[model samples]
Target: MVELQARSLRVKIAQQWGSLGLPFLLVAVVILFSFLSPVFRTQFNFLSILRFASFIAISAVGMAFCIMAGEFDISVGSMMALVGVLGASFVPVIGGFAAVLTTIAISSFLGFVNGIFITKLKIPAFITTLGMMFVFRSLAYIYTDNVSVYIDNDFWLYMGNGRVLGIHFPIILMVLCFVGGYLMLRKTPFGRYVVAVGTNAKAAELSGIHVDRIKIAVFVMVGFFVGISSVVISANMGVANPGLLGQGYEFQVITAVVLGGTLLGGGNGSLGGALLAALILGSLRNGMNLMQVSSYWQQVVTGSVLIFAVAINRLRYTLMGQEA
Candidate 1:
């Protein structure tokens, strides 16, 4: 029995390691480059990386939950824009915390509607979220009048720029968010239900899981996170410009989530991996800029990495199936 248990432990360890090996390898590459570049470890560069990581990391945490719950929300980019606009407009009237809460509440409502369409109406998640993405973008533009609104460095604004130990407040908040998210996904019954629902919705339902409720919860959670991200990011930038603020955010968040070894098919994800992947991407981008890589070249490199990473995941799953 001891030998049997030892073998099982070894296999489990190997499987976990295997899942994360690619992203770790990518990180190793960045570390190697940092050694060659004197600029990589500078305080400025490090803070810059954190600033970038905080924005995407917040959204990725929510994305992780949604993916684990057997759904995806490509609409987060637009949702971020929505939150930014709402927060900027409402903060003056309602104060920072209240304004933020109100915006998140609205975002959650929209997400709940999406969930109803997905789970109750039997609409596909990808299609519904994609459509909502456009709708939100349009709403953001119309509501904000395609203009940027700058806050008066008030409470809402300060949250993004405030610092502790030379790190921005948003970074601290993002770390807290990750810690909270990790607990929710790993230490709670909701975590089990998330994975169970993702793996087999019908089976989970038959086993007494409230699958629809779980799906709605996941969407609402995702919305709240996206809203949180928008609040921090818009403040950091000193203003909100929907067109510029949220441009390509969905791609960035999705890229980080998938690169972190989250199963694209759902039912598996890890905050540790997501955090690491965010760092890796931030480092790579910062490193390239230091190396004087052109913006077009940066896009090429980023795109290539995402494509190759996803392809590798697919191949890994295929081989596992064969081995089984």
Candidate 2:
């Protein structure tokens, strides 16, 4: 009995170590940078890093739900562009609040369409989302005639540039999103159904879970948050350049999620973890900026991080003989 207890303790320790492995590495990076650069530890620098991280982190929050549900939405970047262009273009006539609602509503519809194609039409989530990515991307250009849109709203500008209770609007939004996602995933039935369907669709269906409907619902939720992200980005940047906006954003959010100990294979994720990863990535980028890292090198670094994170995650799963 003592030997069995010892084995159990060993296994439990290993499990915890595995879980914290990513955050540990992240902390290591922070320490290394703090030594290499004087700006790394400054409160102002970290605040700026968090502000930039908020944009990508916010998007990842939405993407997390779909990913945990064993589905993916590559078109969220395009959906971001859609919101920016749509909101910027229509605000002149329809008014500011109306424009926000309209843009978000349209993006939600787009997400609904994506989910339908994947679940109802049986096109597969990856393929459907990938195809829709191009479709929405092209639509952004066509709708805008390749022109940038701008809004001249004072409240929007203030939200983008102003701070509330000493916190930036984008950061506040990111925190709220992370909190909401964490609660939903940890304390709600919908989250359970998502995991059930992700673990085994046939079993979930047998158990009376509407797997496809859940997928659709999650997709819509993802798109809805993506719509908000567009506004944040637009407000911060002070322009809506659809042609350039949201480009590469999808990959960035996906990379952050995976790096945070979320498995790409699905049904396992943590909004808190993903948010932390997002902050790490943003810090890395900010550090790179201070060090004057080249744009091409940044891509190389991102790709390397993605490959390393995914490889480690897959290996952990293989060794565990189940979900990690």
Candidate 3:
């Protein structure tokens, strides 16, 4: 009995490590990068890495929520562009504060529409969101007339650049977003509903859980985060260019979330994992830049990482005798 108990304890420890494979991988990546680049451990480089990681992590938090609800929002990239363009357009008329408010409201409404099409019109989320992506992207171009809209407001710039207690405001906002998302998913009944719907939507509906409403709420939540990211991106760049803003953002955010152990078919997710994965990705990109790697190679490396992560996820599920 003593031997059996010891074996059981060992198995349990192994399982815990298995569940944390992504985080372990992140740590390994950090160590590798630290060895590869002399500047990787510098304070300035660390803060820079954190800033980029924070942006990706904030969006990944929303993406994780959507994936956990068994849905996809490919429109996130275009949504950011549209929000930036619309907000820039409003700045000259309604002032910066109101423009930001209106932009967020519009983003929320578009997200609601994406949910309505998927839940009410019986469209697949992938299709709905993919179509909306192009629609918003086109609208952004038309609205901006193919030109960059520059906002010279100090407040808007501060949202992206201001530091509090030596930490960037965007980094603070990112931490707040991750903490709030983690708490909601772990402590709230709505969070349970999200997991339930993702685990089995039909069963969730049969259980009298408003699955559609929950799904819509999830999409809206994603939209809110994307809206915040849009503001930060535009502010950081000092201009809102429909053509340049949020390009390939959806891919990066989704990659971070998936790398964090959020399954594609969506039964499970981990906010902590997502944040760590985002940091890993940021570190990888920064490290490559330090190494003077080509931009094309960076894209290839990122894509390869996503594919490898998915394979690891599949193996993990299979090892645990669970369907991915």
lDDT digits (tens) for residues 1-324 of candidate 2: 997887677556545644586678678778888998998889878778888899899888878888888888888888799778988888788877777778778888888999999998999888998998998889999999989998787655554666888778888888988888888888999989987877778899999999989999989988888887888888888888978889988988888887876766677776777887898788778887787889789778867876887777666665545655
Which residue pairs clash within candidate 3? none
Instruction: Evaluate all candidate structures by whole-model CA lDDT and list the values in order.
Output: 0.83, 0.82, 0.87
| lDDT, residue 217, model 3 | 93
- Candidate 1: which pairs clash? none
Tens-digit lDDT track of model 3 for 1-324: 997887677656545643577777878877888898889978889889888888778888888999999999999999999999999888888887788778878888888999999999989999999999999999999998989999887777777888999988889989999999999999999999999999999999999999989999989988888888888888888899998898989988998998888888877878888888898899889999998999999989988987888887777666555688
- Model 1 residue 109 CA deviation in Å: 2.1
TM, every model: 0.91, 0.93, 0.94
Query: Residue-wise lDDT of candidate 1 within 67-86, one digit each (tens)?
Result: 87879999988888877887
- lDDT, model 3, position 148: 94
RMSD of each: 3.0, 2.0, 2.2
Model 3, runs deviating above 4 Å: 1-19
Candidate 2 least-lDDT 10 residues:
10-19
> Model 1: which ten-residue window has the lowest total lDDT?
315-324
